[model samples]
Target chain A: MSVVRITTLSKSISNLFKSLVSPLALNSFFVLLITLNISAQDVDIAKGKSLYNANCASCHKLNKKLIGPALKGVSAKYDKEWLYAWIKNSAAMIKAGDEQAIAIYEEYNKVAMNAFPQLSNEDIDNILAYTDYVPEPVATSTTVSGAQSSTGEPSLANDIILGLLIVVLLVLVTMLYLVTKTLTSIAEKNGIKIDQPKSEPFSIWKAFIKNQFLIFSSVVLLLLSSAYFAYGYMMQIGVDQGYMPVQPIHYSHKIHSGANQIECQYCHSSARVSKHSGIPSLNVCMNCHENIAEYNGEEDLEKGYTKEFYTNEIKKLYKAVGWNEETQSYTGDTEPVKWVRIHNLPDFVYFNHAQHVSVAGVDCNKCHGPVEEMEILYQYSSLTMGWCIDCHRDSNVKVKDNEYYTKIHEELSKKYGVEELTIAQMGGLECGKCHY
Target chain B: MKKITFFSVMILMSFLTLSCFDQSKPNYQFFPNMYESVGYSTYQESDAFANGIEAQLPVDGTISRGWVPYDYPDTNEGYELAKKELLSPLEVNDENLSKGKELYNIYCAVCHGSKGDGQGILMKREKFLGIPSYADRDITEGSTYHVLMYGRNLMGSHASQVNAEERWQISQYVISLREKLIK
Candidate 1:
């Protein structure tokens, strides 16, 4: 139902062959190109795009200034002959001391542009024409820019449900009171003895208190409740398994790792070779945040976040990084984002990230839990010594061609007469292994 | 009046209990000594030094052990010189090249495309522009190492992120990528 433009086709066609290896394929591709090139009128934008992607896209874009100035409306800036000569060989023109060529080289801090010597004059013209060609803007996705999903306002639904329940309860109470009043009135009319309802409550309370069975049951109830609360309170101490603190930046691991599928090591890169799983520095955040300055997707307010909330959170990153969107440059007015640490272990215990991640080959989720699904990161594991001992007792060392584990693995396997050795056998459970 | 007072007190009691239930706050610690420790926490400042400097960096000009010195200075002349002279110490083996490719994908491929064609996701999405293809230019291992050591133009130095050997590995990978682009 959508239009498939030649530009998209050209992009795909070029992508089909990653790098031109076969001479036959190249010749046939060129022949196909020449046949497709026979469109006499429409300015050859598709061919130009193909040529541009092959020759120039790696370095230049239509609107943005990357390693060089933007190429949009570039044809208007230079005449045909000058453009052809420049495109054919800029180095020669620069050496010849051509003013324009030298100025362009000087403008971008002397970063040289590659020459397209093989491109014909017409080919260059087509490329210049494509530079002027504009693609139609696509409609914004329903997910990002549309009527928000129902979950966007969860509190309203909860409030309505609560209000309805309260109304129903009030109505039920009123009906019961009316029925009882009517029954009393009928009894009085019939000349029957209608005893006062007030005295009944006190008599019932007194009789219940006098019963030994009731007293024993009350004591049992009190004991059970005390034991329950006491056990719950005692168990909560020093075990912050679900401790999820509010961070300075609202960085959702779910959106990043779950939705985006970014590998954990991409951010926490030092996990593979360091003692500490180092928190990602601001530069790493800048890698993606520099571009993704706003959230466009529909955010669920049910999660206590609005669409604007996420966009504003991204603005917080910009403020910390000191990046100005207009100029697209850092202002050098930087501040460190103080992230709240969640998983804290006792000082006496020793743990090395590189040992587990690099050597043992333990998945990050084995300890960190399903971090990708965590919107707000929590201390998923107990991080207790018992938790550590249990894992070491059960898990085996990843000893496949691992030079670090070769000698130890050989000795342990041979001695134990087992193909695989659990970490405990490799002295993992030793008190000195952790406490020291 | 007594029933009204009792209901008000119950409501007040519930409100008080609700205030104590903060899910974001960590549970009460058992032993302060066992949890808190006698030592200062990471990144915490202490007033031991006269200037209140917490960083215990060695007195100026003393390099830590195992830190090899790079001869090139952070200048354009140094870049040009390194480009002309710098050679990778590591042999061009599959393992080194593979590692180099992996590192390149992590660091460089964000701005420099995976194929070293400069159309990385950032470039395609129009975040950063004008990244040159590896095939387009004449680059050597020295230049790559020097660039990694001291970033040129918009790119920043990656010396802190990657070590000397890793830089060489990345350089080797880039050279191979350049070869592919040239074809």
Candidate 2:
């Protein structure tokens, strides 16, 4: 009876251990799978978010119905296939007399949803998947906690370890030096002749003066330094790399480009066709600022001296155009916003924004280094002839489907036997192309 | 060796000073009386004078300054390219459209309608009839450019009030608003 009881107790204990280990292991495995899935989903969601913000956010909202219907339960409301078809070309669907599409079209007072044939099925799926994700209450709190702890602990620990390692390395090097010095001193004491002089160490300057080899090297160094200085001075004669000047208005590209995501072309529309990506006029501001009297963002509000970012900037514009913003009407005492032009090319050099932006299809970011990311707009690219030539030499023109380049692409392909044609190959680097 | 080095240093200093003095004078100083130096009267009697003396004469003392003329090769090509590359000139948000509509109603609705239908109060009152809806006009980028440059029949030149690029933007916005109306 005693043996049986002991055996039963042992069995129960083992079972308890098994139960504990199994769930813990299972929980970790589940967590690993979940983390991987969540990250992958997050990447797609991020892409969808950007796409939504760019194309759809202007008309549609997630929770609230704006110009279009609320998109909160859009995934559940329509099947994936139907949603894809509707989003791609709503007008087509309506024309085909699709009941659901026609009903939505009528419901929205027949405000036509802009066709997005460019959007792919995968993109729509990702957008739908993003919408379907529902955050758990506990998960939200844990994420916040995790973010705080991770941000603080990892960086602090990394800094501490780096500091400790540096100190240890320094101590080790010092000890090694000391050991060598001690060994050398001991050898000297034992009447072993050392190759190095026992005389007091001379400073580099003194040595340079006394030693003929050092003197020759110093002369060479001096000559090289002068040559380098002369070359650098000539190269940077008009190159204003860090040229930040006070503008007529404190127009922050950080605010407009970075925060607001105002496309560069919105103001610099001339970039497409004309040589200059021209600065926008007061009327352009009036188009929007006529309604957006105030900026909603906090950063703009705090640093923005004149009530609103646009209002203050518009005030500067008003001063240029002689229009007053205070009374909600034009006072007609305007001055042109004499914005100090940042990028100035040499008289001989010719640069065209249209050629780069329109013909070459080079992203503004390629030359401007993510102007949208900058707070205070600064000249990002060197805008040098060499820089332009280098890019032209490297960058292949987007010739496919471009009606303008179709004929050129064919002729070039036949000549070179290689389909790829760089801008340089297409006369981008010619002296006349840049200079004339 | 010391004597030779000292003499060389002196020569170098004198050369530097001489070069500095030479550079101090302006480029035009060589020809103080450029008209007299060129012998303007003698050139006038020459057979080349028949074409125009103004063309023969060198540009007075002022440097050419190498001003590159702003070349807009093809206006139509430019507008099409701009449309493809540039963001919309007007921010077409709800607030912007609302303000645009309001402005259109106040300033433009007398001729162009609240919905830009070309049937404003002015048209109803018969003040100006046949104000074409923007959509009805088979407007290319060039046609818009032309209209903006030189005003049409009744509409006076808005070029004075609006700058060159703003006209393009207004044209773009007008086209967009027209699109909205037709739809």
Candidate 3:
């Protein structure tokens, strides 16, 4: 009992000490204590941090309210024995009509906390210690600056070299001009007449105009080139191949698909079964975004995609979904996000995402380009008849594991006298296949 | 002077034509009637709806085709009851397990970890914290389905993305992962 009292007293003193010292000083003090290998409490704190992250972090945050209340300095609010009982089985305490437990349960909309019967009293103490632990401010700015400088060096040197080359070229040109000017002046002074061939070249345009054959041929050439250009321009009409539109919300495919490695079909799930790939509803965004309210990943500062910018975009999502971050509830007022469509096929064309994505096992990247790498999505394919026909002519129909194609694949391969049958041979290039 | 004027005019015309190409806007179609659908397309904007959007929520109490109604309430008591009583309707087989694995990898594996070890890429990157491992949790097939139907805590309901059969398949896969973890 005396030992317990003494440890409690020590804990109070440490808590007071923690409040008094600045982060830098406290960190230094901790380093000194750790090096001395005398502070067992510090070790407990470390263990507590890991334990807290493993068990408590999902619902409880130290400085902010998540599913539960902010748990910072929780030890100060309740008795140690009571906390132990509560952590072990809060539902039991609530049912038993414990005032504190019931109050908490009611306060958080009767959302009962998950009981950690697996965690012992010692582990709870460690977790509590972790909750009270104040992390030292890391020297991340210095490291970031160092990285920026290192990466900036090559580009900076290249710019300097480029500027030097330009300056040299300018100097050479000026020197040539100066030399020619001085020589001309000297020649004039020395009475050496420098004949200027100016009028003859100026009349060359007139001479060309006078030649009817040359004029006619040139006019024909101009007309043919203009016709060719007009045809090229006409062909490109309504073919939105690189048509990138800014979305209502800035959704970075690079971060989600590339950095996070989330599969394309995870959000565009209808691609497996439906005609359209389907623009994911706002609820899909909430699947991951509900927990991840802030941006902690990489940033492109030059493009103004900062942590705050990304976080604000998330706030826009919350607004559209009508999610109140503080209370963690929907306000029942929703503004549907009007996402601009990037890829569109004309009404005349019949295209099924499921046919390509699931049946054929065609990769999304084959048409969508490297969507994982794109920060902004754009139409990668021209979606023209020629483009479709080209792919159908070259690409083989995926026959493996498809029972429906078993007999047809064999017959077609035999008829074509080829080892494999292209999609065109499989009637993919038929006019009726795409046009209805 | 006339030639210079003509050349300047040509340059100006070229610049005017080239500058008209705006990437943000769609290009001019040969025939708007043919290019655009006369019938309402997916996500088309029309004055027919009150919300000024094409997609409308289903009428109250109207069930969609193939959508099985989930009777379990979204409450702590419901969670406990579901955990205790809910059973998988689908039979355990290689086909279901394989399909479950594929779906799980696409959706659950992002944060839940592929091995159900609570050490997914998101966890490692510190995006999500305190994701309990399947072995650590007191879970059953029922609880897993319940959680998937009406998402518990931070997770949102994936019912929209996956159907009932897919959910059961995923639940079976999760149980299998838990079994593997126990060993």
Candidate 4:
């Protein structure tokens, strides 16, 4: 029996050793092959990348369809000679009735590719090499995401500890209850009474009714509270301070303004010259969205704003804008994105955005709050008459370099006997300034 | 016992009142007629227009106030012709250059770096790629204006955001940036 066991054990050990060594040897061989392959094409790819970025990147992307077709593995699809001729002058080939050229021209809505007579055959070969080059994903990235989860482990631990505490407390309470029951039963068996306080029936309401001072005080307190509540209810009637309506599109101001650091006036261009800060038309969106088709930004997975979720939102934008991504052309079918307006002043009030934004040079954040930080935009202020007046009273008027305001500012400063003048002092409080 | 019940009821009432403030909906208006405009406000949905929207596009042939007609077409040949012939009406002055710089910082600097080195924030972030430096491209004032009027390649037309004067101002600034880069 001992001999048989020893033979089987040796066989199992050899099997385990072979299993380990075979995979290790194979992995090293593949790694060596990949590294050699990369080194061989590295120089060509480096040059090709710069050339491709300069000449081709404006219209073409590596994998995704842009204004032109995807350039990844493009060499496999067409002959090198044909690619060379087409790259130099695609229009000439289409005119010459080349079948492949014509097919491409027709496929891409007849948009002629820009002729690059500068690029030689070697340059073209390098570009193709660059297109074919795919970098292996680093193992460290998974470890980094793993590290992020480990950082989050503290909160998970805290939750578990709290749950354990609750369970412990529950157990202790039940045990205490059981102990008390047994003790009471033993007391009853031993003919010993725990408590026997004999008293007449009592009613809290009756006692409270008998107390005149308490009743009077309670009535006054009730009246005061009711009046306070009523005042609060009336004051907030038209406020809408935190109105955050769901927009047709989930356009995160946080992503655009905060993370991207885009200036407020980039989209709200009208704020510089007009009374209203007009909503940017769809073309403004197309300016960036045409190129940035995917969402590769940071995500709040807990909030369900995942990578896929943001990408879906981008798709919704494309759908509303009627852009055919495959053809890279407008379909002439668009539905309006009805963005819910958050800050709406009363009709009587005349709030000029240019006055605040351009003339006064007030920061957009001064009124709009930290709009960049807000994931879902809501009214930061009450937008009430009192709120406007309060700002006008406190904030100094910005007059420097403003030709329109210079004269008024000088006169107002002289009249007020101060170097600086508040907007309220400069006739901002005048009824006719806002209301006719 | 009665007092506890009474106090709980009051607490519940307060909670209900507080919870009634739904953020998704507008608050109760004192007078909606006073708050809302009688006249058609900008971007308002209405029955007056066939499209049922207040913000309508200008008629196909009609020109709004202060609009200068651009003669150049959007074709590549038009781009070449415009590059050679289009001249800036605005003189190269400090005021114009400064205004141009300001406008460029707002509109162009996001993609076309402030120094026109093609290292703008967007380019650095890799959102946009292969933006040529101002010095790299042999662009004149006219070509710049034409490109601004009708955007070439990946760029969209900025005409809607800026007026003709602003475009010329931006072009002047861009030329200045190119000169600085060349130096």
Candidate 5:
């Protein structure tokens, strides 16, 4: 009974010291919580977890190295008193030439850590405990998901394809057998028996062996079919319609475009007027990303990308843009993020994004495919000459209310006697329209 | 002979299967010269170019063909002066308003919000604060253009992103949004 009271007394003192800023809430809640936690009074791991998440989560992760180092077993690395002082004011210690403090400051590229003067020793301890806390592993969930989902393939599609192939093979075999049987029956009915001659050589092509004309024609047919297939394979050599490259950061257009409904022109603003749909510079990223430093999607891992994966990617952006989220100021340590360009038109093709987008009013999705739903962007269109010519031939010119085309439209309509004039009709098919 | 034929058929089948899988690879171009031209990249530095820079800047005090130079300087005085004087060159119509709305949603709404109440995604998430409501301010099309031309406070200049025509269109859209917010 005495031991129990002493432990409870100690817990209240620790919690009181931890929550000094919010004393009234702590005192009132501690009384209620004491009854529930009367027996095992130790480091409140849950309280620590919430506190760590609220304050330190933006720059720190428990197991992974984030903007700051991982906090897992961080309590073991330094003395309790030192940690308390450092956490409360790291810059002061670093300025004062404290060896350990200066080392950490330098280790993280001289980017100063934010001071948490309000967090008490006990509160810091609670955070440390939460970092050390590990839950039991669940292997079943990962295995179950892995078995169901495979990249570039859905199980249903695979089954359907296999079923179709089997059906095709069965039909071909049945036809061949039927044809052979019918021919043999016809020959037997007419008493034209195909007998083995004593003088004839034993050849594999017995039927065509004696007939030079039949052999020559069959060989010619085989050669023509092989050439057809070979020509088809050669034609598709450089047409990378579905080329998906891994970028420096895993930016999901699906979440930004589809889920958030950010307009395509918002980031790629130059697409409206420029020849190229420009890759958004880092400054464009910082416009929203300065505030949106963390990712907290209310769902399971998407396409095997865990919560940690996306959160870290955002951190990489911060590092690249030299943003210090703590003071919300740039740290002046900027580096250019090398992004791999996906859509590349050949030198011969003079494609103007503005001509198609601003002038013609083509949707970005018409050429880029359904980018809104893409987890990773890829070249959506074949972008062949035939593809461009086809679009120009069929697509109607938007000349109704658009001022840019109205004058040209009136003259063309009178000349051609057609109200709906395609882009092809408006000199879109001219060699000089795209080339030179 | 039969075994050799079977092996050859198996080899052909494997080649067919492999071809089906390489979907990400592009088709071959007949002429390499057409595909890859001998030209300098836009941003790449060249030894022969001045300052090793490829893109050249226009002479000072000169504007491009379509773009007119903004007269007012970037200052508080400029903002105040433009507010009283500046009026949109373009008239208020469905054409301008829709384009204005579309442009607003692109550049401004990410911070200022679609409704212009300053409760954009950045505000709702508490990433940034203190963005004033359009209705709260006494603004004119000129002030809006001045702000876009040379940014105020936390917002940076958007002159590079928008043209003079687009700037006018956006000012029209913002004025309409302000009227809606006033109600």
Candidate 6:
């Protein structure tokens, strides 16, 4: 009986060990799987960095505020889902009477946060992840100075490589020429007889008449050259791509658009609705210059008329509009500001600023090529038919959740099976759309 | 054979050279005016009158060489179609609206109210009354466009404060706010 009991007890102990060990192993396997999934879903830090610079870096610092609240610890304050919702549509949430949102709104003295509904959930997640995983801050001056020094690294390396390549190519060509010359001289010195080339059996005129291939090639070359020249001539027939004219006043787009970040609409207010982005009159300048009275930049100051320069420009506007700054009133001697218009399309062609700016949702930078970045805003795009059509062909229309395009969306889906609909697909390139 | 070949080559080169040579200078064309054409004794003569008319008639000859006629039709349908297809400019999107609203409140809310109710401090202070609530007006895209173009009532034209499209966008936002208020 005791022997039997000992065997049974040993079996039971072994069974218990088996059950415990099996569960632990399974548990570890699941834990490993979960960890892998989380890592896979973790935000891409690189993308986050770029998105931050493009959108958020202008206003908010990681640890301090420039224009908006510091974004650091923002991820900790809100859950991922809440943060995404808040970032995407903060105003809407506040309007919907979310208490937390309202408190934040009130705390900021009702200064509304800009809505970013266009941002995908993934993008917001990435931004949040970036905020959460703050790398230790490097010393600002060191990094900035280091960046300045490193700026020339790529260009310097490229120059050195290019110079070396040219030298090597020159040496190779020289060697080949020298070798050929030496061989020819050696052959001549050895008195090796070389045959003179055979002449054509026919007369020169007759030979030219007989050579069909040569004739055909000559005709083809002529036609090709003519066609190439004609094509270039036709392309530039109406397009004033780099038409930088001397303006009546030396208004620098580079100053206003580029450095100040004063919006294009600040001056060209008519872009949204009118066919023309009407040049702002002198009165518009008076709106701001009335108060500013001086150019704050060192360059403007160095140009001798620091105080008198702006005063003179304002006076010019005053002369146009007949305003007296001393009286802070209109003198009625106002002459209309004769702003030399830029970006002139042909009279035959009709271009509307409103359509591009307001409806299709293209940024001025897309066509104007970073006017804010320009010192003197020149016409960046060719503003040609081909250029317009090419953009229409490539650029996708902004149609996400827009009620204005609900019918269009339905029709487009039916026609193209819900593929990405570009502007060209929407008859943007139709001749009547532009030419008329 | 060599001499013949050389002579033919020379002839062919000469033919190529001769084809491009134009010795004559281009003549400047002079077009006389109709009045000049009917000059001297016939200048003052008129078919309607039996006797001599005015001594000189206005000359008509120097027509604009570069002038091209406007080709597009200007009918109502054409205008409407053009307006719909090419003129209905886009406004600020959700992204820009947020930014616009932020900008608006900073600059405009002091006078226009957060809701654009026109009950802003200026209104409250009795400085500027009758600042219309966007809802109160029968504002279409066109009418809204007109008001923005030429300032209505007491408010001066905001042409300076915003660009044309931005004003339109602000109009869109105002319309949107109006819709919200109605809701």
Give Cα-based local distance difference scores for all models. Answer: 0.79, 0.62, 0.90, 0.90, 0.79, 0.62
Listed in order, each prediction's TM-score against the native is: 0.74, 0.41, 0.85, 0.84, 0.62, 0.41
How do the residues A1-436 of candidate 3 rate in per-residue lDDT, one tens digit apiece?
9999999999999999887877879799989988677355444888898888888888888887788989999998999999999999998998899998998899999888888898988888888877777778788889988987786688779999999999999999999999999999999999999887778766998999899999999999999999998898898888888888999999999999999888898899999889999999989998888788899888876578888999999999999999998888889999988899988889999999999998988999999999989999988888888998999999988888889999999999899999889999999888899899
- All candidates' chain B TM-scores are 0.85, 0.42, 0.92, 0.95, 0.80, 0.47
Q: What's model 5's lDDT at B28?
A: 57
lDDT minimum window of 10 residues, candidate 1 chain A: A143-152
Ranking by TM-score: 3, 4, 1, 5, 2, 6
Model 5 off-target regions past 4 Å? A1-204, A211-214, A298-303, A403-411, B4-17, B20-27, B44-98, B110-113, B118-133, B136-143, B146-157
Query: What's the lDDT for residue A300 in model 1?
Result: 64
What would you estimate as the lDDT of candidate 6? 0.62
> Mind giving the per-residue lDDT tens digits that candidate 2 earns over A85-150?
999999899999999999998886666776778789878866776566555666777886686677
The per-residue C-alpha lDDT of model 5 at residue B100 equals 94
Q: What is the lDDT of residue A415 in candidate 4?
A: 86
The candidate maximizing DockQ is 3
Candidate 3 local lDDT, B96-147, one digit each (tens): 9999999999889988999998888888888889998999988999999999
* Model 5 chain A: worst 10 consecutive residues (lDDT sum): A296-305
Tens-digit lDDT track of model 4 for A1-436: 9999999999999999999899999999999999898667554888999899878888899988998899999999999899999999998999999999999988877678878888988888899988988888878899968976986788789999999999999999999999999999999999998885433235666788899999999999999989998998999998989899998889899998888878889999999999989889999999999999989889885577877888899899899899998778899999888888989888888889998887888899988999999999999988888988999999997777768888888888888899989988988899999998
DockQ of each: 0.29, 0.03, 0.73, 0.68, 0.24, 0.03
Q: Which residue pairs overlap in candidate 5's backbone?
A: A236-B27, A237-B26, A237-B27, A237-B28, A238-B26, A238-B27, A238-B28, A239-B26, A239-B27, A240-B26
Best by TM-score: 3
- Backbone clash count for every predicted candidate, in the order shown: 5, 11, 0, 0, 10, 23
lDDT of 1 by residue, A301-405 (tens): 556577789889988988988988655678989766777878778777778999888777788999999999988999888887778889889988888878888
Interface RMSD of each: 4.2, 17.4, 1.1, 1.6, 7.1, 17.0
Model 5 chain B: ten consecutive residues of lowest lDDT: B20-29
Q: iRMS of candidate 1, one decimal?
A: 4.2
